[model samples]
Target: MAVPGCAGTPPQGPAPRGPRRVPVSLWAVPPVAALALAFLYPLALVVQQSFTPDEGGTSLAPYTEVFASESFRSALTTTVWLALGSTTGCLVLGFVLALVIAFVPFPGARAVARFIDVFLSFPSFLITLALLFVYGTVGMANGVWTGVTGASDGPFHFLTTPWGVLLAEITYFTPFVMRPLLAAFSQLDTAQLEVASSLGARPARIVRRVILPEALPALAAGGSLVLVMCLNEFGIVLFTGAKGVTTLPMLVYSKAILESDYPAACVVAVVNIVISVGLYGLYRVVSRRAGA
Candidate 1:
């Protein structure tokens, strides 16, 4: 017999079993399998093609050829420079824009921010084309500059030049950098900012000590995204940068289309994928550290 208030002992010979196993639904399996096949299979094919030998069996000849070519070397260098320049420019401009939108008191600031969002939604190639209308040799800004200075030509040459491509990229991607940073800034604790201010921290000091650290993760993530976008950019470069600039993407296009060298194109594409993946990994590590 059990004591008072004690629960009665169970009379079962076996313990109660857990819930029955539920099989994954057929609907879910199809979508998952479709995604794997559609994206992963093509990517695997590209990687395999990159390794296929020009002469016969699997070899590193494609990669070796890419690295050995002077054109490839120049293209790689130009790609790196363009990516770095556009990324840095976007970061600087976007950070400043985000700060103004988030903290500063100004008329129509909300409207301006909304407009930026709208602008970001527009296609990047369209922005590049619009820039041609404003800064190209026959564009309005150049025309005005030429008229004002009585110069033989426009002060700026944005058509088919590296600078043109860089400028176009920065304009297009600045919003990419801005949106994440603005979100981060908006999420910051106002109480902490007030506390810092009450402790006699100057505006600059408070920003440096309190704000930048909190925003670093967003900045890093956005910058990495911009870098990746810039790395794979082909449309704008093809239009406004055909003169002297030769990026990896452009090389891949040229090889595939003009030379009909599918293997070489695959090789260039594989290199791009590796570089982008490596950079994204680095960004993730850095962002995690910053958050910590």
Candidate 2:
């Protein structure tokens, strides 16, 4: 019953698919390959160096030396205290500043915020230098106090002390904490606050029950970042730390530069990396819980 041309041919199956052609670009391969060579290779080298002996033997002698040394123990303790103090100070100041900026309208608020942003862009070293000029024995405060009291002694002897280092860290890292907290505060629902107010809830009650809960994640994240930064700090310490007030970074520097002990330096570096990683992990867990 079929037509003549149709009757001559049998039913055909679907056509077979051709192999997919992957684009091979020179651009794509070079970047990934170059990254492996540059970053990964260097990190691997350091890890190898940490484990291997400087004299061509395998050992954990450097780690033992680091653990047994009284100086290292003292330095580690000092570093922890410095980091904790700095982080705490930054959190308190940054939280208050962020709250004011977010909730309180004032003349030149925008300008003030812009000024803070610009200040953050300035070098930490420059700030340290300014602090030296303002706080050192021959500095402004010293001169003023001496003139007023007719005393030979300075008003504040925080220069080249742990307190000075902590102050510098808080000043530098407060911006980190403030920026995130400000964003968190800005994103809050004003309607909820108004509802609470209308219901005769005290301002303190509303902040405690609503605002803080909402902002906790951001606050924790910012605080954790500042803490980690303080832990790894070196520049401010170098400029401000006293003779016996050696932090972990300063100790590592001493070992590497002063004593020419690369292995011992590596041990301290590894310890720093471990502590940083652990604290960051803890931050992640807390942040996730707060968000949930």
Candidate 3:
């Protein structure tokens, strides 16, 4: 045994500590559990319901029935077309608006951009209803035109057509595109643009070369978001009263609420969710690549 106070006793470095273990995985458990409770369980239920028809254990009968139905096919086709058209329209119009607000030196460009942001707070159905006020047969356009021109009809009857649904979706979703695009434009190296301008690159060519390439990632994100939303948009198409604009979401609503076909509705809902999730994944991949 060593003496307590003798200088001959070797100074002991801290008694060897047991290897420190970082419980890094403990941090992940809460989020993983939350994700399972929030997403996985609900999705499993939806998938199970989609497979069940007539209270049976499991079958693909619901999917088969939905695929065989003419209305289902028509609704899916219409939804795809409308989603594509609306996303493209939003990309074009939103890019132009964002460019003007970002690069163009206007007095109130920032103010206008902020004003456009207010649209995001408004419910989508409101935009459709507002369009009705402007373009409905007995609404403002018709009322004013008929009164002024002494004509029996109004100039705008497109409200009940596919054009109306497309327009409403674009109008509602363009700000989404604009918000991301303005962020993208804000980060762009204006020095590159200035150099292109000095080299006599025309506006359109400069946009095609320098601007569009840089903007593509933001465009992908915005377009994916808009496309997914438009794919599931019910209020805009329904409120517009567009006969040709029934989307998959509208089909799900009608099948469940009007026709009481819960299994078919679940099948359609599952498809819509799959598409939205897949597009969201693509957006993530594009974002990562752009960052790299």
Candidate 4:
């Protein structure tokens, strides 16, 4: 063996060191700080304002007054029913559409499925606008009706109603439900469908037996997300121009902007946050259970 420092051989320096890795905890600091500043800080301010009334002392007077108000109660009722109704519509419509797209082989079926991924990027206002173009007072449907029947005003006045808000919400949010379902459907075993078909199972039976069980987790995940979103949805309601359809978000806007009642606005905002956060936690628990 050569000596430690041979004449012909150049002695090796210390092995080259790669860059030192920062600890994961250290890596997390920037994002944690950013989140605290962007989200937590504002949320804390809002929560603080909710308790500290405009009269200057911290008290529950605002909450008590808001809770007792007829407008608050009406807004609360409208918000809950609309969110629930829209979520139900999205689930049923999304489930059926996902099944057809995933299972039923058809021309451009893949293209339609791909379009759904793009559709998710669309804003809620765009959907509401599109619905308005089709169904607004002087929109295409009414125009066609008026032109055909020589009527002064068409019967399509629902666009300014709560149902219009519901329709717009469903149209916009259904894609959210569909995206998760299509992903879940992709992972499903086609062999089960084939075997079920071979066993003389009817289409409904196969869907009910083989497919529904597997899709439950995705359904729960999508439904929970949709519920939270619908609860916070402001654009669709606002764009629908349904003055009578006062949601919690609208109430918050009305209180803060129109009435200049910042305390009441903060209280409503706090209540909305509590509901959304509670539902989001439920979503997290369900997602963990489903491994979704």
lDDT of each: 0.88, 0.84, 0.90, 0.93
Best by TM-score: 4
**Model 1 C-alpha lDDT per residue in residues 20-96, reported as the tens digit of each score:** 87686855988889988999899999988888866768988888887898988899999999999999999999998
Give the CA lDDT, 0 to 100, for residue 131 in model 4: 93
lDDT of 4 by residue, 1-292 (tens): 5677878777889999999998889988999999999999999998889888888989999999999999999999999999999999999999999999999999999999999999999999999999999999989999999999999999998979999999999999998999999999999998999999999999999999999999998899789889999999999999999978999999999999999999899999999999999989878886888677
* Per-model TM values vs. the true structure: 0.85, 0.85, 0.87, 0.92
- Compared with the true structure, what per-residue lDDT tens digits does model 2 show for residues 1-292? 6664586777778899999777888558989899989987876676666777678777887788789999989999999999999899988899888878877889987787777778778777777878888998788999899999999887688877788887888888898888888778878999998999999999779878988887777778888998998889888888774667898889889988999888888788888888999999987787687663
| Backbone clash numbers for all candidates listed | 0, 0, 0, 0
Range of the 10 consecutive residues with the lowest summed lDDT in candidate 3: 283-292
Q: Using lDDT, rank the candidates from best to worst.
A: 4, 3, 1, 2
> So what's the TM-score on candidate 4?
0.92
Best-to-worst TM-score order = 4, 3, 2, 1
Model 4: which residue pairs collide?
none
Question: Candidate 2: where is the Cα deviation over 4 Å?
Answer: 1-35, 289-292
Predicted structure with the largest lDDT when compared to the true one: 4
